[model samples]
Target: MDSARPTPGLHEALAYLDSLRAGDLAPQADVPEDDEDASYDTLDALVDQQDAKPTLRPSPDEALTAIAIMRLCHAAESAGPDLLCPRPGLLSLLFVSSHEDRNRVARRHPDLWRRLSLPFPALMIEDPLGRVGAAKDFHARLAGRLLSGNGVLAIVSGMAQLPPELETLVTARATLPPITRRMLALILEYLHPGHDVDLPISENQLGKLAPVALAPVLAAETLDTALTQLRRLEDVARSPNGGPGLDDVYGQPEAVDALRQVVSDLDAWRAGTLPWREVTKSFLLTGPPGTGKTMLAEALARSAGITLVKTSYSDVQKAGHQGDALKALNAAAEQAKTGSPSVFFIDEIDSFYNRNQSSNGYILGMVNGLLTLIDALSATEGVVLVAATNDRARVDPAIVRPGRFDRHIRVGRPIRSGITAMLSAAVADVIPGPDLDRVSEQLVGLSGAEVTALLREARTAARKAGRDLALEDLQAAADRVQPQLGDALMRRIALHEAAHVVAGHAVGLPAATLARISPRGGEVVRPHLNAMTARDIKGMIAAVLAGREAEDIFFGDVTSGAGAGSNSDLAQATSLGIRAECAFAFGPSLSWISPDTPPTLLPTEVRNRVEARLQAGQEEARKIIVQHRGAVERIAAALLEHRELDGAALAGLLDGVEVQADGAVQHVGGHDA
Candidate 1:
């Protein structure tokens, strides 16, 4: 046998064209037929009968097509035996990137192309000019090979620009994903049969090279050295160039610590020292907006010496059509999985719904697709998945369930210590003994993004004035971002927040994480009540309404702080009451309303029960406030003087407010006395 490879069949196709010109080509109806060459009416018939695996000795174009099949089908070859590749004619489209890539897969239907192991085919659109032409007879010849009976694979590079008549043949369409590091390794290994070849370079580095880059690897004297140099250059390019890492992240000690452990595990894994399953590669971050979920992911990626690819459900859905959006989502998932030592940061992940018959089919498809992608991603060795959502309740349970996301980390607003550290870092030039303790207290409840925004404005102010950023400038900037409330209003805000702390504690709720007064309103960020029983639900409602009750008791009135917005105290209390009556069967009827039903749409009986529940909660809050009046006053005064309270100090303050289950004013053991 000659060692030379066979023509990619395009040449044979041309020869057949030449045969046609010389009047030697037989008509299709008159051609000889056999089981191997007989036309199958359906692709299923071909798939069911043919079990031919791809040829062991595949040309570069065939290898490229294999990678294309994997991408288009979203199938990873690393997934073992049972993972079947699609049959030949089922691969309707084959997308490739550039002219060189186009040349590799175009005009050539190799034996391997005839048996594609992919469910979906890729579609890459380009103008194939002279290589393919608009000649009247040439059209007939090209279509003959493409639409042939015995399965011809159409590798689409210039399929889009094909004459309308030819383009119509493509019933479905798709775009090609980039050549991943794993794909590159496969191509090299396929080329050098029996050799263990692994590229030490990242997908970013691999993507910079076309399929043609393999020529050098196949020709190189030392395979390892070439790969080492390529990786070394990229490592240098990716060096710590003053970018933020986990060390730079301030506040949220638990989140930082958890991420640091993950980074350590990833490092050990990369060093080939850690067991595969020992790494917890995925975690869900739940917190209010701007708590730095994305920032933490970025820092974690930097610490791990990997790239961070940030995307969201909202971003993927921007592709318009459900099919296109799903394609975009698949592409994003493949991008991260292929690029190992990477963090796939998906924000607003809750936007993708859990499977519900009531929801549109599009959402169900997206949710199903996301779950599959996440499963593949979580199982992949080097990928660290960081998914964030503000409302954890809205997230599909399956997506956030243990294995899919290893754990949940609540990235709350920074406390006093975290705030101090953030302020100190922001003005590094300031003397260590400066008043950051006070500065931190003043900005305690603000989100990290809000703080960063104020700091940026301060720096900009200094820059515009041609001066260094002073402590005064920082304070001035904070004032500008949120103008300080009047003394009376400040006191009221402090009282409002302190009441929430005291009421929650009195009702035996968990310790509040933070309590602060801001210009917009006051906040007492408590651990979720996780209220289970009817009484627990009612107690939580009391705590929700305590701010209003405190205002009513102390100032003989209430502010809009507890009522104005949809997220206000009144809204929450009402919601809890509605849930108790309408959904949870905690009230009158055993029947329930549909999920996500608005309160206004509720029946008068249910609405009345909800109102009655609210009234009872108000009475409960009033009793707590009246009993702890002195402690409430003192804590409020302290909050006004200090601007915020948390940790040991806040715990001490709340601990002194003694609780008597029967509504009696009890004495403090040692503190309040």
Candidate 2:
């Protein structure tokens, strides 16, 4: 062989020499006589003895040396004479992990491993756990100790669990030193040939290791296609129609209108010479789950003819580290910026503002970082920032305060007519039976998403049983989709709501148009009158208490159903009673009191007086139920049979007796008239 060529035997000999010095070589029992001139002869005799003992299983150290030699030979053979020469004088110290997968891969495809490991002195590390802190410390110490060289210092492990500090160094951002950046760039080039050696190394490790990491990047014609194939890679999904346009959204005309107005303003701002600040681009959408808040965000973007960048709590958390999360957030914003006239929607805004989250450094840093990003996005012109949360109260006030999120729109559950429209829209494709109205009536309290979910379930059932979507299918789906409030609980709920309806009618309050007792909950959709006198308020309070009172009368005890926390009927009644006592001064007290007036300063007798009023209301409610026992029983029986009753049907059951606003009952005809 030419002296210029590094022969495999010479490479192996050098490897064995290094291993011998490092104590990785196996011990020999035969010792040659002490003589400096005969040392080569002794080494040859030791090699012959090892060859004779080839049956011996290799030790960890021996196996490692063999792996290195195999990689060298495979690299030479595969690359031929054009082997990519290592940058002259560069000593890329790679911290090779003895992780099981890493070892297995190195052994199985030594050639591939060698090609990737080129130009780096692979140092086998015993750390299998791949702790980021330890890795960072190791990298920092090694970089300092080995900075006299010109090559890359790498920690090669199969595990992709990188800490934020190391990630920053890899990206060449944050506080990473210039020398470290140069070293990282060389490593990156080793991994990807033709990568710019001079350009700054800002590429994240996750992206660089995409081909070998747990999840690899998949190229596709469109983002939607990629998402369809690899759901894990998707962050923002293209809306079917700019994310279910207002027409596609089931309900909440008020919210849709507000979004439309904002879009119109955005258009004017974009077209005319008006200041960008004049346009309303940020909104806080508060709603319960399944209420289409996310859909609305997409719709707003679509309505404005803009792209939607949708990110969520789970997405950010999936990124693993604070640096990774910030990268994701920055990528989302950058995508929106590049695709101008875009909407950046952050779903579950409360996740970032949750006080309940642990004060762990990572979580706090992530939330603060996200807040800064949101504020920055608000300053941008073309991107509208719409964030959604199930409850606005859960989010920190600072996040939703003026200037950050200036507009607030509530996407509440669909009311009666809204439910009708939603059900109609959902079933537009199916041929329904005459009982569509019945289905709509039964599905009063469902959200737009719930409505669609039920329709999908019902459609599936209908198709499976070889039938078109029908009322029976819808009802069956409801029974399956809705929570199964046991027969006993459902009966109690029916009686409770029926009692409220009866008490309302008896006390000159309008009866509910539709009354339901579902597994999820119960509701009596009574007439929504704005103005109320003290008597009307008292009647309302009585109606609220009648549910519990009815349970008490029938079962001798009340369920927690009546004592729901905070926002329950009991709470509402108490609030109204207190308001009447203080704010409205409709109580027995002669003096009018402001709502802000301290209750402690109020005469101590006011509390007693308020309790008395509530007690009287309950008593009045009980008396009405007792007087109209037959009507109450009839309504309850009808409710148990039908699960719900329309106003017209309920009116016929009560013989046309209708409550008037003037606290009087009048005999009326059919409810339709």
Candidate 3:
């Protein structure tokens, strides 16, 4: 082995080399063995995150040997005190930032006590449960030690979890420096002379195994085989506890397809067949909650076979002050970079609202820090950063430009098939009694989160009633999540959705993008028509009110659904009309009025002009609806049968209809899909 890279502990390595030349490097300090707390039962009893059976941890003796090997390798470097080792004036109030089992402090070996000059029986408390138990016996034990003038080391996952009663007694807080590759390489060389120690593992991977376990991993017949074993160990330690991969996710095929392509690209890049810049590395998952935005990040990481460091801006701020928060934020960035071929996900990015509200230093620091990290990670080759927000409009513009998040993927509520799959999975263990396809149609308006919650409600009832979950329990829960609308309303929604598609196409829309309806409600993704021309404005206005016009023409009256919310058909039509008149100067009046201005405050003349445009659009929509009655009926029938008609399917169903946006007829089936 080339001895050029001596690592940080050169003194220790040289002494060991001299001992090889002379004799043995006798173990320093006759440190007594203290393996009482290292017992298997104690480690088992500490905490079980999963309700299921816990995985087997290293044996007490195995852990001690690993620790001893690590100390010997980095003898001089690790001689200083850490959180778990306290002597007199040092090692007070050390905060461990990670909740991973590998990052948590293990039972201290005998040499650790001698090195730190600590008591023979050291006492340390790490509250993985945080402050919830602060008022319990924990506070009593900590306070007693402080009052007695005895040394104590208290560790917490976060500073906020530290009760105010003992805040004054705190000296400092920090996270332990993890084991690094340099140390491991030297350990390998020391274990087997002339052995190649230039391994590919990173510091983050080595941090998982306790010091004592390295002998077994490095002692494999060959270094290649040893590496293979270490990879399996790292995978187990870093797994998101068996999270679902891209294939396991049921819906959002567009997002899934995009992620799968990136996964392929990642494989190609690693194989030297694709350029790193061509890879789509950054993403923004924007949509309603319970739509599995975070789950998508998890799936992407699992599908790509990489690590995922999930965090949020709030998570960083929880570290304490602005300085510490920035440190924590930087640490997350470093972890992502070091753990290359990694996915770094930050949730609730909308909270970084535009920097105009930078009233305090903390908010500014966080936003600036995040932007810096995003910029740095975007330039990185194998790292992918995925950010999620329930409210996309609330996010700042600068943070979401083309260079930052290359794709803005929308994760809407699952379609009928996705809902059916979810329902089937929830009750897979129970007796299968219900036709979930029909039930999924009725529950189409519910979000994935709502479906999970309702199922949980059903499980509770089944457990209370002392019987397997039955069709009645599921139906009862489904009703609570989304009440079943009768057949009459269901047909009406189908017609409402179908009319938008038919009218939009008749008015020369690029195409009907999406048409979906449930028994309770429905939605249609309006054709994306900008105000590039007055004709475009007129087309959008007509399509917006087509649903209302269809209802009025068929039923001789209109339901309040059209005018229900700010995003309703009537509201959208009014908005387009206002923009046409005031913003676009396409209407009779050239007067400009802010859309945010309430209708009551608008000038009488401007309001009249806007009202006139709306009336004309509604009349045009009525004409188109009447002309496309056959097209509307055919599509509506399909929606009732399938609960959804989107993309090429909806387009193919409208192939026979011929209309033009210029008020002229055309036979082309061209679309912007």
Q: Write the per-residue lDDT of candidate 3 for residues 253-290, one digit (tens) a residue.
A: 77888899888887676544677789988888877778
Error of 3 at 472 (Å): 2.5
- Higher-scoring candidate on lDDT, 2 or 3: 3
Whose TM-score is greatest here? 1
Task: Please give the range of 10 consecutive residues that has the lowest summed lDDT in model 2.
Answer: 171-180
lDDT of 1 by residue, 122-156 (tens): 22223332221223344444455554432233443
Candidate 3 lDDT score relative to the true structure = 0.66
Worst 10 residues of 1 by lDDT: 664-673
Q: Which portions of model 2 miss their true places by more than 4 Å?
A: 1-243, 273-275, 354-363, 426-434, 482-519, 523-556, 560-673
TM per prediction: 0.65, 0.44, 0.63
Q: What lDDT, from 0 to 1, does candidate 1 have? A: 0.64
| Deviation from native of the Cα of residue 318 in model 1, angstroms | 2.5
- What is the number of backbone collisions in each predicted candidate, taken in the order shown? 3, 0, 3
